[model samples]
Target chain A: MTMPSTPRPGGRSARIQAAVHQAVRELQKEQERAELTVPAIANRADVTPSTIYRRWGDLAQLLADVAIEQLQPDQPPADTGSLQGDLRAWLIEYFEEMSSAPGRAMLRDVLGTPGHANAGKCDGFLRQQIEAINERALARQEVPIDPEKVIQIVVAPLLYRILFANDTPTTQAVEALFERLTMPTKT
Target chain B: MTMPSTPRPGGRSARIQAAVHQAVRELQKEQERAELTVPAIANRADVTPSTIYRRWGDLAQLLADVAIEQLQPDQPPADTGSLQGDLRAWLIEYFEEMSSAPGRAMLRDVLGTPGHANAGKCDGFLRQQIEAINERALARQEVPIDPEKVIQIVVAPLLYRILFANDTPTTQAVEALFERLTMPTKT
Candidate 1:
């Protein structure tokens, strides 16, 4: 558990990792989470269970490694006319995706991973998305708000509700957060 | 994982559950998390491994049940007169406790549990703590903010930091959040 999860692999390692990851993704689509043990994944991946244990430390770490990769945005955040528009659009998408059944499972994998490295890597995706939007805002001559503040104001609450609260978070809640963040402060 | 975790029990069930839970708590102290197999726990509890699996489904559910119970405050949140004072003191202490190593593991257990029932139960504790503080505020004739909003503003951020962020949250950060929450609104 103290060992670092190889979330990102390279060169020769990528081949084995990809096979194992693909096995995980397909199995996740096909069966129950309780059935997703290390031996099952290793068998499907054509590798020994010892390989999984040696590389990922355990099943949770392996799932986390796969989840962190999948959760990454395939492309950068789309540009909108205004920073407000861009941020709102991005957050709405983020919230909806994370609230979906499959998305929640991915979230559980990353957060449940005992080593925080995978979680930290996932955090980077949010910052990157925000930065992309902020860069566009700066280009448009609008003052860019800090990414950390956006994370605190929006992402935290959405995730908290998604994982812990019995009720699902509504898209309107994300909108409300965006409005609250963008509205001019009274002096 | 699909079955409900026996987070609380009544009558005769309590005796066996207590034995199992106490064994888990003690074993957690003595061994690595990876070494805590159902057989080991059952052996310590003086029950068969089948008993552990039959009752709890898996180690995650059993661990989650224990975690949610330990998270419950032994006493109610202390009254510090005003809602602001009470909330600030309460959140600061909460932030510290939850950020501790053992606290993070407990949080992981609750969040990682597949059923989500345990996680929801843990959420109730936060809401209950807030209600206690707000009741005191009402007695003093001071307006009490929504408990949900307090959770949204403070608890969400603190937990996001504790569970996901690479760095730990600071007491000063809690104070800053409290100030923002209590600050006068500009029209």
Candidate 2:
């Protein structure tokens, strides 16, 4: 079967994106069972090893792209009119997604690659995602700070607990998080 | 050279732990340059491939074991009574350790392995580190809740931000984390 565009100029970006996503899905599946290689992914995506390499930096980068794409929730959590509701929904869903095999693999790949540690890129991307949720919280007048930082503070612990502490965010823990972030300061 | 070990019947556990840590350090160095192998690690640690595999479960497991060992930090931050001082010290030191190459590698290994999703292990390990500081805070009557829970909530974001968001905990951000967590509740 003809795969999508390769990572080149012209019509290649879309095709390349599709091919890369497919390759990532395949690699993620393999990662669940065992380690994956560039050749194996190339074969599955029906692309050449050189083509895959040329497009992405390496297997890690390719995997990273796929992981990021997939790691993002399909859409931000719906605005529930309250900051607590919105954050709860967002965090619980986000945590559940990260706990998935693909989600976990993507997290591992991102964490694995050293060059991926560009804070500006990571912050901008995170701020963007949090902004979407933040805007909703703002519209509802539920959030107290810039929605972006609020989101980071609210949801960050979920990802952290999962990745570092290895603890899933229990309902109690999520509520605790909500209470901690959204509470008005006692002056 | 012989390393320290616990006196126990299953000398295997301590031996294996040392081997795994050594292997992880070597592999991570190689991974930085994009070339790592079970054999290379085996050679560096002077252990047979069979021994490495037998002890750690697989290459990923061996990699994970080494990385996992680093997750447990040495001690908690000094509690100087003020939340800001305690948190800033805690976060900066913690992030500095985890944000470094070795810390990043350990985070990656934890994410790489599927079986490590158990956060209970992480919580227990971190509580010990956090308690060292939390205890100091408690002695000074600095915190409101259980020191363990406070530690978890306070430090969770730092670890989370680093591994998943690929961001470091800035001094300002650390302050924000403390401010939010330390805010008095409706209770």
Candidate 3:
């Protein structure tokens, strides 16, 4: 799942990319992804349709790009001097964001879009985030566990509730999940 | 979440119900749930649409009934005389079934149907199965753990892979998940 590179910072081309991404997110909030069109997005962003075509190739590519951008953390959660604290903070923030209206709409678009295999892209982003946190822990001389194990223990259940069960995870559920994951192992 | 009662055994009505259920499953394999209709099901089952309506109330109700029926084990996985063995066996079977074509179709219908709210029904069935296993473990004098905890460790990851990531959990992944869950916790 190779994601599209983020546009280079500070230029006319970068500005257009930003505007287009914002338009895509705003449109997702207003309607399902099935209803979005390149022309409509061009109109929303005040860019020409040919410009979007030249840049994005098609509607699916454009939507995929937007989905990936929304998933990237504004800034990765700050380190809290312990792996457990970092994980808890990161996940709590993630859960809260995912439960917000805009977040839910973004998720629906990513997951429910026809013929767009965005799950792998999302999964890759999750793996990268967990790996980054584990790297921080390793630097602090804390033992690093498999990021996959962390995902199974922490991220999977919260997502299961959100997508399949249509339930927002409670703070207590988050805490319980973290506790179970970080509990001392028996010899 | 009140699942329809399974019909009693050995009668003409039971026979019709069985035919209808079989028809539903076969049709699910053949087409998406959105394409299913009472008349179509009746034609496949060689029964009257009136019979389907009289018995199941609506297409959504009929579909839900079929889903629950398929999900219910002929007999829940046998106790392997240890909690770990029992859990591993149950989950491996569950993982295989859910990744099967029929199972995936049923899951999609249960999750994707508008106004169908089948999550509670599915959740209830899972909790019931877990409790039954726990009771058997307690009879053997094994310590009981929170069923919700077990769900988080075992079921959630497998499901997340299937529905969100589009990955059928590898055997290695399943084993790792179980090992993590069963690792002894410090007091």
Clashes in each model (backbone N, CA, C under 3 Å)?
A: 0, 6, 1
lDDT score, candidate 1, position A81: 89
On DockQ, the leading prediction is 1
List pairs with backbone clashes in candidate 3. Answer: A186-B184
Better of 1 and 2 by TM-score: 1
Native-referenced DockQ of model 1:
0.73
TM-score of 3: 0.63
lDDT (C-alpha) at residue B74 in model 3 = 69
Q: Candidate 3 at A81: error in angstroms?
A: 6.4
**Full ranking by TM-score:** 1, 2, 3
> How does residue B162 of candidate 3 score in lDDT?
79
Q: What is the lDDT of residue B53 in candidate 2?
A: 69
Which residue window of length 10 is worst by lDDT in model 2 chain B? B1-10
Better of 1 and 3 by lDDT: 1
- Determine which window of 10 residues in candidate 2 chain A has minimal summed lDDT: A1-10
Q: Write the per-residue lDDT of candidate 2 for residues B11-105, one digit (tens) a residue.
A: 86666667657766766666654566677877877778887666556665656555555665655667666544665576667667777767766
- When summed lDDT is taken over every stretch of 10 residues in candidate 1 chain B, the lowest stretch is B1-10
Worst 10 residues of 3 chain A by lDDT: A108-117
Q: Candidate 2, after superposition: displacement of residue B151 in Å?
A: 3.6
User: How well does candidate 2 match the true structure in TM-score terms?
Assistant: 0.71
- Could you estimate the TM-score for every candidate? 0.92, 0.71, 0.63
DockQ of each: 0.73, 0.35, 0.26
